[model samples]
Target: MHFQWYPGHMTKAKRMMQENIKLIDLVIELVDARIPVSSRNPDIDELGKNKARLILLNKSDLAEEKQNDAWAEYFKEKGFSVVKVNSKRGGGIKSIQGVIQEACKEKIERDRKRGILNRPVRAMVVGIPNVGKSTFINALAGKACAKTGNKPGVTKGKQWIRLNKNVELLDTPGILWPKFEDQTVGLRLAFIGSIKDEILNTEELAMEMITFLTEKYPGVLEEKYSIEISEDSYECLRRIAESRHCLVKGNELDTNKAAILLIDDFRSGKLGRITLEFPEDYE
Candidate 1:
C-alpha cells in the first residue's frame, strides 16, 4: 500500500514552529522508540539549527529494550541529549529536568555572563504525530497541562507550560513534512499509527505488518495467535482471523476486524517489545 498523509494543519504547524523557534533556547524532540528514524520530522533539524536538542525516545516501553538503548546512543552520537521514556507511565520523567538543565547549560552560562540570572529555559517540544509529545510534556510537568490523546493531531496549537522556575515548555501540535522522500519512511510511520487509520487500508497494512514480523520477528505471530506461520502474509492474517474468531457473517473471516486487532496489538505492546528499525542498519 502506498502511504502518504499530510493534513492541512501540518503546514500551519510548521510555520508556527519556524516563527517560534527564535524564542526558544532548546528543541526537545520526541521520537517513537519503535521506529525512531521514521518518526522524526527532518524539518525540525533545519528549523532548530544552532539550538540545543534533546531527543526523548517516547514510548520506549513499547519497543525492544536493547534497541531502545542503541537508539539513544545513536542520537547521542549525533549530538542530541537523549532519554528513553515511557511517558504514559512516567518511567523517565523525573530525570528530564536535570537533563534539560545539562542540555542548556551553555545557554544558561551565556545568560549569566550578561547579568541574567534564574532565567527559565525556553524549550519547544516537537515531534511527528502520535509520537507522544503531549503525553511527555504532561508527564514532565506532573499535570495535564497539554491535551493528551491516543491518536495524532490532538494538540492543534501552541501552549506554553511552566514546569518550574528553571524550565518552561512550549507544546506544539505534532507536524509531519509535506512529503516523505522515501516510501519506507511513510510505511514505517503508517505501521506505528502516526498516519490516521481512516486514510489507510487496514487489510493491506496488516499484511505488511505480518510480512515484517515473519521476516524480522519470526514465531511471534505463531505464539500470539496459536497458528502456524504461513509464507504468504494474507494466509497468516487469515489464520489470525480464524484463530481469534474474527468472523463476520455466517463464519466468514472478518479480515478487517482481524487487521485492526493485529495493528492494535502491535501498538499496545501485546505483540511484545518490537523495534522495526535498528541503528546498525542506518550505519
Candidate 2:
C-alpha cells in the first residue's frame, strides 16, 4: 500500500530543532519500542551531530520484552545510551537522571576543567509524532509538565522544564521528516499510531496489520478472535467481524468495523506485545 503523512507543522518543527540543537548538551530521542528503526527519523543523526545522544525505547509495556532488550542493545552498540521505558506508567523514569549524567559525562567534565561548575546538563526531548515523548517528559519531571495526547501533533511548541539543579529538559513538538521513502517504515509508523489514522484507509491499514501478524506472529488472530486462521488476511478480518458480531443491516458483516476494532486492540495491547522490527535485520 502507498503511504504518505507529513503535516505542515512538522516542517516548522524540524527547523526549530536545527536552531535549538546548538543550545542543548544532549539529544534524548524517544523511539517506539515495537518499531524502533521505523519510528526513527534519519535526519536526527545529522541534526544532532556532535551532541551527546540518549535513546529511550518508550512504550516498552506494549512491546515484546526480548525485542526491547535487543533494540536497547542495538542502540547502545551505536554509541547511544539506551533505556527501555514505559513512560505512561513511570517505569524507567527514575533512572534517567543518572543516565543523563553518564551520557554527558564528558561535557560535564569539560565544564569542570574550565571551572564552569554546577551547571545542569541541558537536554531536548525529540521523536516522531505520538511516540510518548510528552508522557516521558512528564514522568521524568515527576509532574504534568507537558501536555499529553494519543493523537499526533498534540504538543504544539517547545517548553522547558527544569528537573533539578543538575538537569533541565527542553520539550519540543513531535516532528516527522519530509517523506518516508520506504513504505514499510510508513506502515510500521502507522501501526503504532504515530501517523494520523483518518488520513489513511483504515481497511487497508488493518489488512496490512493482519498480514504482518499472521506471518511474524502466528495464531495471534486465531487466539484473539476465536476464529480459524486463513491464508488470506481479508478472510481473517471477516472472521473477526463474524466472531465479534460486527454487523450492518442486521446480517451483513462489517469488515470495516472489524478492521478498526482489530487495530484498536493491537494499539491497546490486547492482542499481545508485538515488536515489528528485529535487530538482526540491521546487523
Candidate 3:
C-alpha cells in the first residue's frame, strides 16, 4: 500500500516552527525509540542548524531495551545529547534538566561573560504527531501543561510553558514533511500510529506488520494468540482473528477487527518490546 499523510494544517505548523526557530536556544527533538530515523522530520535539521540539539528517545519503554541503548549511543555519536525516556510514566524525566543545562552550556557561558545571568534556556519541543512531545513536556514539568492525545494533530497551535526557573519550553503542533521520498520511512511511521488510521487499509497494514514480526520477532504472535504461525501473513491474520474470536454474522472471521486488534496490541506493547528499525540498517 502507498503510504502518505500530510494534512494542510501541517503546512501551517511548519511555518510556525520556522518563525519560532530564531527564538530557541535548544532544539529538543523527540523520536520514537522503535524507528528513530524514520520518525524524525528532516526539516528540523535544517531549521535548527547551529542550535543545541537533544534527542529524546520517547516511548523507550515500549521498545527493546538493547535497541534503546544502541539508539541513544547512535544519536550521541551524532552530537545530540540523548536520553531514553518513557514520558508516559515519568521514566528518565528527572535527568532532563541537567542534560538541558549541559546541552546549552556554551550559550549559558556566553551569557555569563556578557553579564547575562539566569536567563531560562528556551527550548522548542518537536517531533512528528503522536510521538509524545506534549506528554514529554508534561512529564518534565511535572504537570499537564500541554494538550495531549493518542492520535495525530491533537495539538493545533503553539503554547509556551515555563518548565522551571532555568528552562522554558515552546510546544508546537506535530508536523510531517510535504512528502516522504522514501516510502519505507512512511511505512514505519504508519506502523507506529504516527499516520492516521482513517486513511490506511488496516488489513494490508496488519499484513505488513505480521511480516515484520514473523521475520524480526518470530513466535511472538504464535505465543500471544496460541495459534500456529503461517508463512502467509494473511493466513496468520486469519489465525489471529479466529484465536481472538473476531467474527462477523455467524462465524466468518472479521479480519478487519483482528487487524485493528493486532495493531493496537503492538502499539500498546502487549506484543512485547519491539523495534522496527535498527541503526545498522541505516548505515
Candidate 4:
C-alpha cells in the first residue's frame, strides 16, 4: 500500500530546528532500530553540518541484536558516532556520556586551547515522530524532563534539560519530510508506528507485515499463531484471526481486530526481535 504523512506542524518544527541548530554543539539523532535508514530524516545532514553528530538507535531491545550492530557500523561508516540504545529500559544509556565526549573530542580540545573549560556540550534531540527522542533524553538525563507520548507530535515544542555538568539536551518535536520519495521507506516507518495509525488501513498494513515475515522470518507467524502458513496474506491473516479468537457477531473471523492485534504485537516486540531494514539492503 502507498503511504505518506506530513502534518503542517512538521514544517514549523523543521524551521525551529534550523533556527536553534546554531545554538548547539551536537545533533543527537534518534532512529528506530528496526528501520534505521527509513526512520532518519536526511535533512539533518544539512542542518547539522560542522556539528558533532551522534546517532542513537533507540528502542534497540525491540530489534535484532545482529542487525543493530550492523546498523551502528552503517552510521559510523557514514561518519556518525553511533550507539544502539533501548531508552525505555535504560540499556546503553550509561555509556552515552563517554561516547558524547568522544564524539566531541575535537571541539573539546579547541575549547581548551581557547581557555573555555568545563562547558557542557549543547545537543538537540531530533527524529521522526514516535522514534523515542524525548524518551531517550529522559533516559540520558535520569529524569522525566521532557514530555513524552507514544503518539506522534506529543512534544509540541522545545525543552532544555540539563543532563549533567558535561551535557545539556534540547528536545524538539518530531518532524517528517514533506514527501516520501521512496514508498518503501514510508512503509517501513509505518510498520514501526512512526506514522499515525489513524491515517493507515490496519488490515493492509497487517498484510504487509505478513508478507515480510513469510519471506525473511519464515515460519515465525505459524509458530506464533499455531496455524499453517499460507501463500496468500489474507489467508494468513484469517488464520491469525481464528487462532486469536477474533470473532464477530456471527462467529466469523474478525480480521480487522486481528490486524490491529498483529500490528500491535510487532510494534511491542511480542512478534520477536524483528528488524525491517538491513544495511545490505541499502548497499
Best by lDDT: 3
Predicted candidate 4 versus true structure: per-residue lDDT over 217-279, tens digit per residue: 997898888999989999999999999999999999999999999999999999899999999
Candidate 2 accuracy as TM-score: 0.91
Query: Per-residue lDDT of 216-235 in model 3, one digit per residue for the tens?
Result: 99989999999999899999
My TM-score estimates for the predictions, one after another, are 0.91, 0.91, 0.91, 0.91
Candidate 4: regions farther than 4 A off = 144-159, 173-179
What C-alpha lDDT values do all the predictions have?
Answer: 0.86, 0.85, 0.87, 0.85
> CA shift at 40, candidate 4, in angstroms?
1.0
Please give the distance, in angstroms, between residue 80's alpha carbon in candidate 3 and its true position after superposition: 0.4
Q: What is the overall TM-score of model 1 with all chains considered together?
A: 0.91
Q: Report how far residue 138 has shifted in candidate 1, in Å.
A: 1.6
lDDT of 1 by residue, 1-283 (tens): 7875546777787888877888789999888999898888788889999999999999999999999999999999999999999999999899999999999999999999999999889888888778887777777877545432232332345566778888877766446553578888888888898788999999999999999999999889999999999898899899999999999989899999999999999999999999999998789
What's every prediction's RMSD, in angstroms?
5.0, 4.9, 5.0, 4.8
Candidate 2: minimum summed lDDT over ten consecutive residues — where?
146-155
Q: What's each prediction's clash count?
A: 0, 0, 0, 0
- Pairs clashing in candidate 4? none
